[model samples]
Target chain A: MSVINDLLGGFATALSLANLMYALIGCVLGTAIGVLPGIGPVAGVALLIPVTLNLEPTSAIIMLAAIFYGTQYGGTITSVLLNTPGESASAITTIDGYAMTKKGRAGAALTIAAYGSFVGGTAATVGLVVAAKPLGSLGLAVGPPEFFSMMVLGLALLVCLAGDSMTKALISGVIGLMIAMVGIDPVEGAPRFTFGNEFLLDGVSFVAVIVGLFGLSEILNTGTERPGKVETPGFRALLPNRTEFRRSNPAVARGTVVGFLLGLIPGMTGSVSALLSYGAEKRFSKYRDELGSGAIEGVAGPESANNAHANGALVPLFTLGIPASPTIAVLMGAFLQQGLTPGPSLFVDHSELAWGIIASLFIGNVILVILNVPLVRVWTSILSIPPAVLTALILVFMVVGSYTINFAAFDVFVMTLFGLVGLGLRKLDIPLAPLVLTLVLGPLMESKLRESLEISQGDFSIFASRPICVVLLLIALVIAATPLLRPRRRKTRSKENQHEAA
Target chain B: MHEQNQAAPPDRPSPPAGPGPTGPPGPAASSALAPLIGQAVLALVAAYVVFTSFGLGLWSHIGPGPGFFPLVLGVAMLLLALSWFVQERRRTATPAAAPAQGAATATEVPEVPVIPGIPSTPAAGTGDGSGGRGHVLAVVGSLIVLGLLIDLLGFQLTMFAFLLFHLKRQNAVRWITAVIISAVGSVGTFVLFGAGLGVQLPAAGIPFLANLGL
Candidate 1:
């Protein structure tokens, strides 16, 4: 009842014309970029960072949060309408989504996606309200050692669950940490690896690196493909039949739970959660044969999971001062830039603002369903543009966007360099998400560790002394051990063999 | 070593696939030899990391230094790399190999004949796969040359030349159009960053381009 009343109060603030307009702008811009193939929410949010720099912190955060979910919702249109996937999270959606289009049930797939996103997003937001207070309470007792151990445990989670090659994943993670080390040492204020270059002084601009890696790499990949232009049909009647709805309901429920849980875990964000849910659904679904053949469950599961993951990732950010996803990392950055510390204290200090953002999520999810479902046809038409021309335009936009960050040409060069590096990593089949996540988390982890060490007089035993730290370490050890012992791995191999035999 | 194998395509017939060169160049390398190459690359990277961290003073610090974390990372990498190398060698020593898939497209060479008449794409898409490596090299080479030329000719000229090359190559635009577009792009960038945003553009050796009329 308190949740509802507090939410109603939040709604009054978020419902104001100015705040609502920011949310709308964020939603529309997020949808536009999200519908475009290659660029993900990471790039979309990063590109918007400079623009939001001047806005009030609450409005900026609301807008940024809206964009994050907006991309998750909008990305499904391309996956369904065209064979191309706008985000890696949507790749599973394409398997069934494209199949649906081939079967002339594109309208149904699009409708399910929009509604699934809304349901998952709204559910996760409700979960946030329920979970955050208690989690924040638990976090209040945490100190630097607990925080450091948790981060290490989080990084370990990525090592275990991130796509193949634990060694490569670790290597990439270390590289990210090294990149984070380039700036001044927080403890001593001594320069570490800048090598006297003024550009190195700031230790690689986050905006420059992200824009270059995601935005630029996308352009390069776009340049590689043979563009297939298609025209989109507009304004379809958006309703799922009883049969379609019935089939998807269970998957939607399962995906929401799966995505929410995954989001709660640091390091594995929306993309991983969505993919894992898709895999789980395939393994357990009674309509397994219908999967990858336009099964509504296919669309429902991943779309729901991705949005749920996006909303639920906020739980850790607001409660623990740990960003569970890259999008949240930027939002955390925004919070820090505003001189606000994000932890248990934030809830007590800024209840209205926090609750208002929470309240606005419900409004945002409802708006996304209303706008995205009827407009998916229009969104799908965007893919019809030639990849070459489209990528060129994106490259131009990336340059303009990066330069606009600090209005520096050097930043443009940095974007290009990172783009090439991103392309190189792609060619090697190395997943970039862990690298980005590590880079985002590295400095905070280091600072917390240093703080803990200083507080403990260099006694490392403090890490194990705390109950929370001990539990997280044990969980990490168990996660690290399970893969080596799991019998299901062989079964997976057998399935792969069968797939190859087919 | 086993960890490196995780990056390779599965079903290489070895219990713990050695980190060797990634999958077969074609299909047959899956038996034993391919993983050796992958292991070698991983090993090399591991070695480089160790050397770099050590050279930057990892172990010699009186207390905790900047190199401390990297040293731990390097040792971890080394252990993994060595494990992979040993696994690959052990696999290679075994003799019986699985039947390998022959290059199915050997007789049917996938070729894209360059049309003598058609203008080449300014962009590299739809080109022969050969151009992929070439495109990467070209971009790298372009950057190097721009770095060198910027001091002599200035950013505006270098960027203009670079854009002109792209406009002509990919878009196959008319000379006038290329010139106009390049000029507009360069000047637009200058004004937007320099005047509007208060960014300081690099001054050109050429007098006219240096003066923003500020």
Candidate 2:
């Protein structure tokens, strides 16, 4: 009853006219962004941070959160119509989704995806509402030493699962930490790496760096390519048969469970959930044989899982102050920019704002279904716009966005440098997720480590002496040493994977 | 599964695969030089940080000083660079020690995107893997030029040229189309953001241009 009452109060705040309008705008723009060829949710969300700087913190966060989940559904449009994923999470959907389009059931596939997303996203929001207070309570019990160790664990998980090479991922993570190390030190207020530059005083701007890495690099990568062909699914084609909906219902349920569970882990992103869902459908779905042949279950399950993962990711950012994925890491940056610290403190200190943001997510999910299902043709047409035109406009926005950060030419240059760095990293097959995660975590991790040391009177054993800290660090150590310990096992597994593919 | 690449069959024209995640990092041994260059840069950066941290003071009475963490990070980076150098030399020394098993399999299946929104692979395809460098270089060079010229010629003028480069030079659209698109992108955004939204933008650094309302 107390939870329901709190939620009802949240409804009161979220239902205000201005807040609702921001949510709507967020959903609309997010859909367009997801439909864009080169940009994905990370760049899309980061680009909007500068735009949101003018709004109140509550309204800013509400709009950005709406955009985050909205892209999940929007990405489905590209998958079904063009056989291209708007984002990586939707990549698996292209297999069955494009097949459905070939069979003249593109509309049915998209409708099911939207319905699955609405169900999964709404269910996850309910989970968030139910789980927020307790998780936050548990988080409050952790001290600085534990917090420091936990962040290390978070980085380890990120690098371990992020890409092909953990070394490159770790290197990226170190670079991010070094980036954060610029500017005034939190404790002593002495500058560490400013090199006497005024702009470096605040550390490298997060928005500029990401906009460079994600947006600019994307344009440079895909700028010259032509847009692919997409067949528009007419309105009459949208109605899924009774059988189609009924068959997909169970897959949606299973996907929600899988996605929500995986999303709880610090480094597991929505694409991982979507992939596992795809794998699960291959193994456990009743219509497994039809998975790659335009079966509705293939479209519904992974789409649901990805959407569920997007919402479920907010749980950790809210409760434990850890970002679950790269996109969520940018969102966490928004929270920090709003002058609010996430974690247990957010719940206690800003209950109204916290609950309001959660409530608005429910409203946003409803808005996304409406935008994605009946109006999906609008998005397909977006794919028709000349790639040259879109790329040019995006670059313009990128420059303007970076410039507004502090009204400086310096940040724009920083963005350009990172764009080159991003290109180099991408070409090298180094994962960007670890860099993004550590960039968000670096300052906070540093503060906690310093505080823990202060409490221990500068004793290094403070980390090893505390039971929770020791346990967390041990987990991190094991993960970090896996490459050294299990090289033979890794090679064997790859061999097996090759054999299976053959 | 092999299904990853099958979705985009060869018959269809697709977005440039943007240097799809280096599969076996390509066949050329010349590519191995990249790691050496990376190590040299990292080693130099690490050395600078260690040297700078000594001046910043590593310890304070209460706890670690501002430099303490940077010092640690510097040493960590040096260690990782050394490790990479060692690994690469060993692999080069014995080319046949390990077969290209991972590379062979990599071509069969693309890197699964573990993170949503990120491709893990930057470009899905690299169209012809040709003629893209010039356009990319143009963007980089233009951005730097914009940084230098934004204050001189102002936001409107530099943005106009930047957009024009993408539209006219790289993309090779007609002059009218390029002019119109670049105009709308530059002047229109300048008005919406600078005038309407009241976000500050550079007007001009020179007294003459500022007087002319650039």
Candidate 3:
């Protein structure tokens, strides 16, 4: 009941004309970006961040929140139609999504994804609304050690989530952490790797890094490959049949729960939850043969999980000041831009603003579905466009987007430089996520570490002495150890076997 | 079981085969240099990070100074680079055996091994491989040219020229489509940064537009 009231309070603020309009624009633009291959929600959000600087803080936040959820909805269409996933979250969709497309059921797969995302996103937003207050309290208690441990765990998960070789993933993650070290040191106020360039003082902006890595590299790579040609499915074939719906219903439900839980944890990326949900669905599937054969459940499970996680991620960010993902770090930047501290006081001092953002999530999810469904064919048409042209547009957007950041050509130059480096990393098969997440968290981690030291009078044992920090550290150790020690492929195989048995 | 799986008749034809010189048909073969480039870039970036961290005087930070973690990160990065470099070297030196067996059965055997800098024609029919390495190099080269051209020609003219040229070169799309996409893309760029979002874009060549309150 209290959760419902709080959500209503949120709705009252979010529904205000200015905030609502921002949310609507965010949803519309975010979806367009999400439909394009090589353009993920993170880049879409980052690129748009500078533009939002002029808006009222709450409206900006609301718009950002809308973009985040909107991208989650938009990304699935391409994965289904073109086999070119718009975001990492949609990669799993490509398995069965492309299969369904091949079987002439692409429309159904897309529809399920759109609808499932709505349910999951809305459910997770409700969770966010309910837990906002307590979550903020929890955030206040997190010091440096806890933050550090959480990031370490996140890095471990990055390695685990990165495909194929664990060693490669670890190396990639370490490289990311290294990149995070480039700018001015958070605690010491000393420049690290600027090479005497003024831009290095602020470090490589996360927006520039993400755009270069995911957007530019994707363009460079996709240009090298033959882009898929997709034929749009008819409207009659868009909705799933009864049997298809029945199969996907349970998977979507499971995905929503899993994504919600994973999303609430600080530092866990949204893609992780979506991928994990997909993995779980495959492991528990009754129609095992349908696993990658255009299974409606495949599209439903991952899409729902991705959107759910996107919503769930806000719980930690809104309630706890700790950002759950890099995009959230950008959101935190927006809050800071407004002179708003995003800790416990955010909920207490700015209840309407906080709740409004939460409430808007529900409204956004509904709007995303409403906007995306009839536009399914439109999105598919957008996806079917040549990759070369699509990538060219991305290049233009990235250039303009970066330039908009500081209204300086310098930012664009930095974007291109990072983009070249990102292109090189893509060439070498290094994962870009760790580097990004680390960069986003670095300043905060440094600040918290310094605060902890000051409070504990420079005692290193303060990390272990704090119960929450100790537990978080242990969890990090476990997460790290599991990937290293566990026979990952064998575990997947055995899980497959169990599914076959069931 | 193999017979059961081979439900289709011989010469009933496979999906019009993918064109890449490396690997089997489809997307995996398409991603020939993706893994290679991704790894190398990561290594280079890591090296740069290490160099920067060293400049910060990694270990000599006074009580929780920014350089402290960076020092640890630098050492970690060096180790990571070394490991990555070794792995890439090993993979290149020893080509996997399975691909060799698969290659034996493929049609249109090349007279020479596919090497860097060699320009192979796009395989007939498939259109999947534009000898990707060449295209990758071409794009990079064009960008370099664009960079040089920017200060000389100014940002807008350079961007407009680059956009027009790259769009035309990359694919054989309709000239009208290309022109429209370029115009819309360029104009959208102007509107988004200049008018809509109210952020300034590079206005080197067109001083008039800059003065027009755009």
- TM-score on 0 to 1 scale for chain A of candidate 3: 0.88
On residues A306-339, what C-alpha lDDT tens digit does candidate 1 reach at each position? 8898898899988888877666776676676566
Least well predicted 10-residue stretch by lDDT in candidate 2 chain B: B1-10
TM-score of each: 0.79, 0.91, 0.80
Ranking by lDDT: 2, 1, 3
Candidates sorted by TM-score, descending order? 2, 3, 1
Error of 2 at A423 (Å): 0.9
Q: Which stretches of candidate 3 lie over 4 Å from their true place?
A: A1-5, A98-105, A224-226, A266-272, A275-291, A325-345, A486-502, B1-62, B85-156, B174-177, B205-214
How many angstroms is the interface RMSD of candidate 3?
A: 10.5
Q: How accurate is candidate 3 locally (lDDT)?
A: 0.67
**Could you arrange the candidates by DockQ from highest to lowest?**
2, 3, 1
Highest lDDT: give the candidate number. Answer: 2
For all candidates, state DockQ relative to the true structure: 0.12, 0.28, 0.17
TM-score of 1: 0.79
TM-score of chain A of each: 0.91, 0.96, 0.88
Report lDDT (CA) for all predictions: 0.69, 0.81, 0.67
